[model samples]
Target: MNVIETAIAGLLILEPTAYGDDRGFFLESWNRRRFADFGLDLEFVQDNHSRSAAGVLRGLHFQDPNPQGKLVRVVNGRAWDVAVDIRAGSATFGKWVGVELSATNKRMFWVPDGFAHGFLALEDDTDFLYKCTSYFEPANEHSLQWNDPILGIDWPLDGLEPQLSGRDRVGMPFAAIATVA
Candidate 1:
């Protein structure tokens, strides 16, 4: 696996080496020992998968008391994944990173705790999968406004409008989000 750091401090972009033949290809999506070599011995407690239509936007969400560090990838179709650092006092706070993750690219994104995560499906029936370092605690979850001007997330919504949930639509603005200690 090739590990590349994103602009944010702990955020990483991973590309697993794939071995191919005339028949097919094989690659290890996650390996504990290999990751530990890269200083990432994260324990993934949960796996989540979702399929979304084009224009569907889910999140900018994070847990407060028990934050979740995520390893996300696209299994089918394409998506524009984004992560915004919300760690108080950090130099990159309020800054975000965006990348196009697709089945063809087979790249993985590591959005560690202290960040809000979201994705926009660029194609219909996009399958999104993620491994989480912590169990989800709904009560501790909070949403950051995806379109908040201060944060400036450049979502690739050229011809279509973003379809958001009621909870997500009412997400807190950057100034309204409480600082984490």
Candidate 2:
């Protein structure tokens, strides 16, 4: 796997080497030993998958008390995945990075704890999969406004309006959220 580091301290974009032929293709999405070599000694307790139609926006969500570090990827279609730093006192606080993930690209994004994470489906039936380092705690989950002007996330909405959930629609503005420490 080729690891690409983002501007933020721990965020990473991973490209797994794929071996293919006329028959099919093979790649290891996660290998403990290999990842540890890259200083990612992760222990995932949960795996989640969601399928979204074009224009669906799921988050800018995180768990405060039980923060989760996520390894996310797209398996069926394309998505614009984003992460924003919310670590208190960090130099890059409020800074964000966006990357395109798709079945064709086979890229994975490592969103460490202390960040807000979200994705925009660019095509129908986009399958998003992720491994979480910590179990989800709904009571501790918090959402950051996806369109907050202060954060200024450049979501590739084109002309289509983003379809958000009730919780997301009422997400807190950047100033309102408690920064992760």
- Give the Cα lDDT of each candidate: 0.93, 0.95
Candidate 2: tens digits of C-alpha lDDT, residues 58-157 = 9999898889999999999999999999988889999999999999999999999999999999999999999999999999998999999999999999
**Clash counts for all predictions:** 0, 0
Q: Which 10 successive residues of model 1 have the least lDDT summed? A: 172-181
lDDT value for candidate 2? Answer: 0.95
TM-score on alpha carbons, each prediction: 0.96, 0.97
Clash count (model 2, backbone only): 0
Cα displacement (Å) at residue 160, model 2? 1.1
Model 2, C-alpha of 162: deviation from truth (Å): 0.3
Q: Could you tell me the lDDT of residue 177 within candidate 2?
A: 60
Worst 10-residue lDDT window for candidate 2 reads: 172-181
Give me the displacement of residue 115 in model 2, in angstroms: 0.5
Q: Candidate 1, overall lDDT?
A: 0.93
Cα deviation of 66 in candidate 2 (Å)? 0.8
- Measured by lDDT, the strongest candidate is 2
Per-residue alpha-carbon lDDT of model 1 for 12-78, expressed as tens digits?
9999999999987899999999998998899999999999999999999999989999999998999
